[model samples]
Target chain A: MSAPLSLPERLPAISLDDVSRTYTSGGSSVAALEQIDLRIARGETVAITGPSGSGKTTLLNLVAGLDRATSGTITVLGMRVDGTSERELAEFRAHHVGLVFQDPHLLSGLTALENLVAARLPFGHWRDLQAEARRLLAELGLGERLDAPPSRLSGGERQRVGLARALMGQPELLLADEPTGNLDAATTEELIGVLERVRREHDLTIVVCTHDPAVAAFAERVVRLVGGRVDGQQRLDRPGPLEVRSLEER
Target chain B: MALSGALAALLLSGPSHGYELHATLEAELGSTWVTRPAQVYLTLGRMHRDGLVTSERVRQETRPDRQRLTLTDAGRQAAEAWLAGGPADELVVRLAVARLVVPDRVPSLLGTMIEERTAALHRLRGARADDTGGFRAEARDAEIRAVEGQLHWLEGLRGHLGELVARPRVRPADERAAELA
Candidate 1:
């Protein structure tokens, strides 16, 4: 007898088909990303990596709806990011995506807890979000310094606050650009640890654009872009942990 | 990288004693962290010497002697330092070595590695650690992630080197970053 089909409540968190972005300036044109076909399933983590102009951010921006692609379709949690109206995109971002930038731009005057709470201020009552903000800070190991303002926090602490702020939206998908661009090795490692934990706890599908291999390596899959094209991709499904096999050139 | 700090965090909230600490660590961080009791005790002995923690043997009736480990002021400070974090190095040296020696082979493997590393990272982080174990799971997760990161970086080195030495420039990555801004 055929078994009943069981499907996940939600499947791929993000889908991109023949996606491309070209910026035409004065008389010339530049392709930041070209023909990008990618899929990220629910609870997956993917890293987009490339050189300075490989369109890592452009690809991320397209999925985020911060920028539209010249061609192709981008679907995130069932919504069309490319063709959606600005208002719809804005709403989608507010409700579905969490963004962590290279540098977490926190309101200088606000305390760490306040910054997290304030991000969702426009969406809900301040009091309702306060507890969750506190929990996030504590979970990130910043509970002891919740009252500290951005100026008072260390580079690592500030980044943790930034992450906490991102989680405030409770979005299903997270997008980060060079999140560790500013941190030291030890701190970067620490932040990656936090990110790893949060993604699982929150059941988030994360897409990060980074130049750091350490950061990219932490993802479930790494997508490499060369000259704005999908040059190659690999899945880290091999057995063993911390196994270092040097590349023996063919 | 920061194993001591995490080891300290495990003892901070609840000063696990004897078999308790060893059992707790195993339960909280899973095999991704220190699993053996002897290793945990050895670490405790080192921590005892470092003044990050204090260890005491409390005898019980008809049972083995319980080792009570408590976090010291310095241990607490160490945990705090971990939270504050330190400056990061820009380059990953292992990958640099691969690029220096296996330049060609490095790219094919490296390009694939970035993908594999990402996947590796996802699976590592996706492993279930203790949910309510306070900072214990977090510290353990950090330790695992940091170690995995090193391997991933080493693999990724070739990919970047390949980009620099090989591959005709179809377009630069940030050529539009300036204009897009």
Candidate 2:
């Protein structure tokens, strides 16, 4: 594993410098994103909300180092995601970044416990991985589901499994892509609570790509994307629905 | 309802093993359908007893023996009926009424609803690209388009809700006001 890069003096957890992505659609190249500049600080949960074709997913892919930008640089965890080689990006993401796609994406073959253990092994560390995995499963109300296969799990349970998998590696940066898109309201809140717990416990830098303000209400900051650019932004100092407990209550 | 339909569909596709049917459903439903394999097989066993399908053990040279399945005539009839039915107009209910009913969230929810409709439209359009003579491509497209228009109207109403629910804000008395004087 690469040495943890020293963060810049007072630098944010993530910074995007004039990033843009273009794609060929209908025989014409369309700018999926404009020159987007944004910053997210450590332990901050930032939500990117946008309409379809506004490039919310594209922006997320760039930040998560899953895709490269057509232009400009993206600094995440003090490394340039835009210019990193594929191998480096994969390694970096495996160790420093965790992703929750819209779908749970759990391997059908693995049990809930095995799914998380698999995520840990790739980081070249399995010592006590099982214990960590079990703890996470317990947190998600899946203590009984440790041995259950994907087929036996409910829609919500499968999502919980996915969340546990993402956090198993204990990555500082967490990116979620519509993690609650398919969930019912009750399940969505449950999932959000799980996410909030993980974020606080790990002091994670979290970014969520969602169109739902209900989802965005969990974030400390909300950035609206219009035409692939930051249309508006607001810092949510007051507690939103996601914050259910005060420090004293906890 | 979707699961039962899927079960019938898979059985009709071929005499498939219970595990294969579960995998097929997972692939089709993406994230919405969640269930364990053992439970699915147990359900299949129940269906077998109920005369929906038949199951048998097949010898495997590799590791463990395999279970195979075949749909009965009744299963085929069920699948046909399911395929003939149109989409069910059911609202997805959740516990986040505070978020959904809250007036401030109206605009963003409306936007997301529109995005979902657009994605559904793309799916419909793409379905037509393959000349599957079995489906009514034109009718499906029209139906999806109608839903897309309705989502647009919902978006308009949500914007209005945002306006109606916003509280009156009193700006702080500014030093600039005294400077202007």
Candidate 3:
């Protein structure tokens, strides 16, 4: 019998090699992160978790090309992100990376559909964008709220809109910073459900920066950031009966 | 009875040193905790020496040392009795202890901990619904449905918790919040 081939290890969508960030404040240099090394494979959902000032947010910004590093190289979606020019990074983010923050920085005047359609403006096509936006919203259980503005939408609904806005461009990589940071308990759980469904359906790579264990539980791997460096990691699998039993037993 | 009960409750699940027990409890309580592994091992060693339980060296591939542990008949009985009895105030106290010690981390830790619990509940529900035919056929659908319902409820709770941890709190019962005004 021919040897069965295992699933090919997916190529990393993001790589940070010996990356570090330092800030000079009042003639004293503070290290935000140092000696960071990470690899995020395509289609993988990885959670970056830590306490405040642990460099979790800094790591996200670096990957999204929102900020530059003081040392080492960051490669995002096959482009060298660390040394990329400002224009290059902006273009790269627009084309390859989709960002969602804790707060839905949605345009106040725009409807949910309009906000989603806006992602296509930079690329100059709004026709298909609307249809895709509707499809995404409906899939995320927001079809009824599509015409609502940010002010009228509930916390969960708004977060779904923000998620739809991110997916409107169909970017290969999604970087979210505490996407549920401003919701109620019920809404947070609902948002996580939507995220789980979308992640599987879209087959997109998502890196979420959160300290919430609930959020981390969904990720295949949870990387701990400490003192601005990769500290340790926890590997989690889809919880099964055996695992539940183990947990209960534990 | 309180200390013995909590200790037993932890032990009933499996064998753990005092430190690991503390960590698990802290995690369950959703607090920023500091329980050194060495300290746990020390307690286990002492417990072993005291005849509360018997332990043996267990080799783990990823660990540096063989963890010494095993619950004896006395230990299991103690654990079961403790858990079966009732809740203890100290259970909350330990969590408070962890929270107080790590005062700066209260909000973040609580947020993370709530998230973890919510996720864990979802996962447990999902696990129960697997089409393995392991669960009874008659109870399967009802159980799965119940799990799904709980998952939804947990989401709502998590959302509310998120809002509480962060900004201006909105009273769910308040007419303004109801109107989104």
Candidate 4:
């Protein structure tokens, strides 16, 4: 018999080597991020923190293939992300990344289930997509609100719907920008718990950029950015012995 | 019991001196749990007695000898059990007792906690955004929900206590004396 096909070893979820992004307007050039070298391993959770105008979003945009770097290389999921055509980048993103933003930007007219269904429609049959969307929305604690329009849902609920929509594509890497910025403290905590649970369930690699220490506390590693450069990096010890439980036990 | 289990779990990670273990636990738990060094040592002693952990005295260079503790097979199993178990119910009992004894202060205490947590959440929200992607955003959302749940529970508890206990209305002694006059 022919040798059974084996899956390739997982590569770094993201790698940015000497990456920089500069924007020029009116004969003045502003460097958003300068020479950032970062490698995030598969399934690792990292938080990038800095002050405003510190190029935090710039770094995320680069990795998501939303924006090309002005210089250097960007690799995501073992593919070159820095030098790809727009069409190629779009395909790579659709296949490998799930993006969440401050605003869910969900269609206001669509029901929660419909919103998720819309995200998956391009990739699967409508019947299967609708079932998958229902499953995701239910998993995200939106089972009751599945038929509710975005306008009727609370800010937190809408965000959860957005998250479910993101998962509809089943991207390996999840990238969120200020996902909790629109939420109050209580909602933020609930969303964080949901994210953690989802991450564990999906076996995903996640990168979040935030100024909040409370949010950073959830990350295994925290990278500090300042003036468009990496200032410091620290590995946060997982809190509590309860985390020692095996995945099956959890 | 949780602390003892936590200590054992730490050992399961690898062998370390008492002080090192204590530091690691403190770092891990942060302000969530206040762990005294003495409590850690006491638990270590108990765990050693139970044969859940074994210790070896290592002679240091120009320093005091330290006991390097390691988890035994039984200890590893016990640690896993502890990890799988739910949190203690003592917290609920303690809160119930506090509600009875100090009903008036309960709301204020809860309010203070809510304020602190809200401030922390806002601080996190205000932190410079980074590109780590959707995972951190998801993590933040989870945190927001947790804090919101606590606030909701506290608010509900406050309302319940308010209904159960009415603040006593007392006339001032001077007012009574004036009325007598």
Q: Using TM-score as the measure, which candidate wins?
A: 3
Candidate closer to the true structure by TM-score (higher is better), 1 or 4? 1
Residue-wise C-alpha lDDT for candidate 1, range A91-205, written one tens digit per residue: 8899989999989999999999999998898888887799989999999999999999999999999999998988886898899999999999779878988997786588688
DockQ result, candidate 3: 0.10
lDDT of each: 0.72, 0.69, 0.68, 0.72
Model 4 chain B weakest lDDT span, ten residues long? B88-97
Model 1 error, position A25 (Å)? 0.9
Per-residue lDDT of candidate 1, residues B93-147 (tens digit): 2222223334454455444444444554545544534434667667556645664
* lDDT of candidate 4 over A11-48, digit per residue (tens): 57789999999999999999999999998888777888
Better candidate by TM-score, 2 or 3:
3
Ten-residue stretch with the least lDDT total in model 1 chain B: B86-95
lDDT by residue for model 3 over A136-228, one digit each (tens)?
999999889889989999888888898888887678998999998998756776787788787868868999998665666667778988789
Arrange candidates by DockQ, descending: 1, 3, 4, 2
Tell me candidate 2's TM-score on chain B: 0.46
TM-score of chain A of 1: 0.92
Candidate 4 per-residue lDDT over residues B51-165, each given as its tens digit: 9989999998876999989899999887655543423222232233234334555455544443344344443433313315868776655555555455455435544557644
TM-score of chain A of each: 0.92, 0.88, 0.92, 0.90
The count of backbone overlaps in candidate 4 is: 35
Candidates ranked by TM-score, best first?
3, 1, 4, 2
CA lDDT of A244 in candidate 1? 31
Query: In model 4, what lDDT does residue A137 have?
Result: 86
> Highest DockQ, which number?
1
